[model samples]
Target: MSDEARVVRIVPNGPVMVQGPVRIEMPDGTVVESDRFMCAICTCRRSKIYPLCDTSHRRRQRAKDDESSTTVTVQAPAEA
Candidate 1:
């Protein structure tokens, strides 16, 4: 690895772009590592693969008059 500093970019309403290879430690004390040139870290927690961006933050398309257009809100569980 070069002595150069790694870059981290925050995308608006999206994932955080990180220059890899990187190692991440989860709340459960598990360690995750990536050797890619770049990594997309999830910020919305909507990713099926936690800590990795799967583009799940992107909004789904719906017709203006679609009955399913009704929005449902969910609250995150309170931290202990």
Candidate 2:
């Protein structure tokens, strides 16, 4: 558990991917394991992984698509 190393990278349209040894401290004073051999941090904030990314964004994206089906009502601009 020594050899502590941290890797932080930003993934497009997704969460960050962290590699190497990492320690994530929760507000509850609980330190979660951020390295599952490698960690994929959620940037979309929609990851079911909680503190990691399990590719759950796919489902989130699908839900987003479904939401897009609803038409957005825009009010006309007031006459200047």
Candidate 3:
């Protein structure tokens, strides 16, 4: 623990996990520190908490499986 090494992990389609103490400086010079052993940093920019990951990256569940898999490629109308 004396070494104080910090580790970061990029979760697939998810947050960036940071281990150990970390200080995050915002755009306006506001500093946020993590008290937990690990913290999730938002990557999708959808978090209400800005830099923190509130699991906003998760995809919404479709009612039907076909609805989830369907990809509708729309064609533009021909110019008159």
Candidate 4:
């Protein structure tokens, strides 16, 4: 991202849509590039496509649909 870097919005229970010259780093020390200034990334961290929005999480509803649907939410919920 640059000085005028765009902000990536992490929607609750949804994807991380980013707008910018963003760089995506993989767990295997590989890096991916964003084509445009706007892109939707998986927030579930279960994307087979890694750094790209494959919609697999939405299709499978794996980590989502549960109580902890968000990975970037600020506050923790009260225990049940």
By lDDT, is 3 or 4 better? 3
Error of 2 at 7 (Å): 3.6
Question: Which digits, one per residue and each the tens of the lDDT, describe model 4 over residues 1-80?
Answer: 25875677987776888874456665555666665566668777766555666566665544444423223212233346
Alpha-carbon lDDT, every model = 0.69, 0.56, 0.66, 0.60
Candidate 2 off by > 4 Å: 1-6, 59-80
Ranking of predictions according to TM-score: 1, 3, 4, 2
lDDT of 3 at 8: 89
Question: Which has the greatest TM-score?
Answer: 1
* Model 4 TM-score, 2 decimals: 0.54
Q: Which residue pairs collide in model 3, if any?
A: none
Q: Cα RMSD (Å) per model?
A: 10.9, 15.5, 16.1, 12.9
Pairs that clash in candidate 2: 15-43
Model 1 alpha-carbon drift over 4 Å, by segment: 61-80
TM-score of each: 0.68, 0.54, 0.64, 0.54
lDDT of 1 by residue, 32-74 (tens): 6666688788899987666776677889834435423222222
lDDT of 3 by residue, 4-72 (tens): 767889999998998735667776656666655777788999875667766767786334442233222
Worst 10 residues of 2 by lDDT: 67-76
Candidate 2 residue-wise lDDT, 5-73, digit = tens: 566788777778777345665565555554355567666667644565556666434544543332222
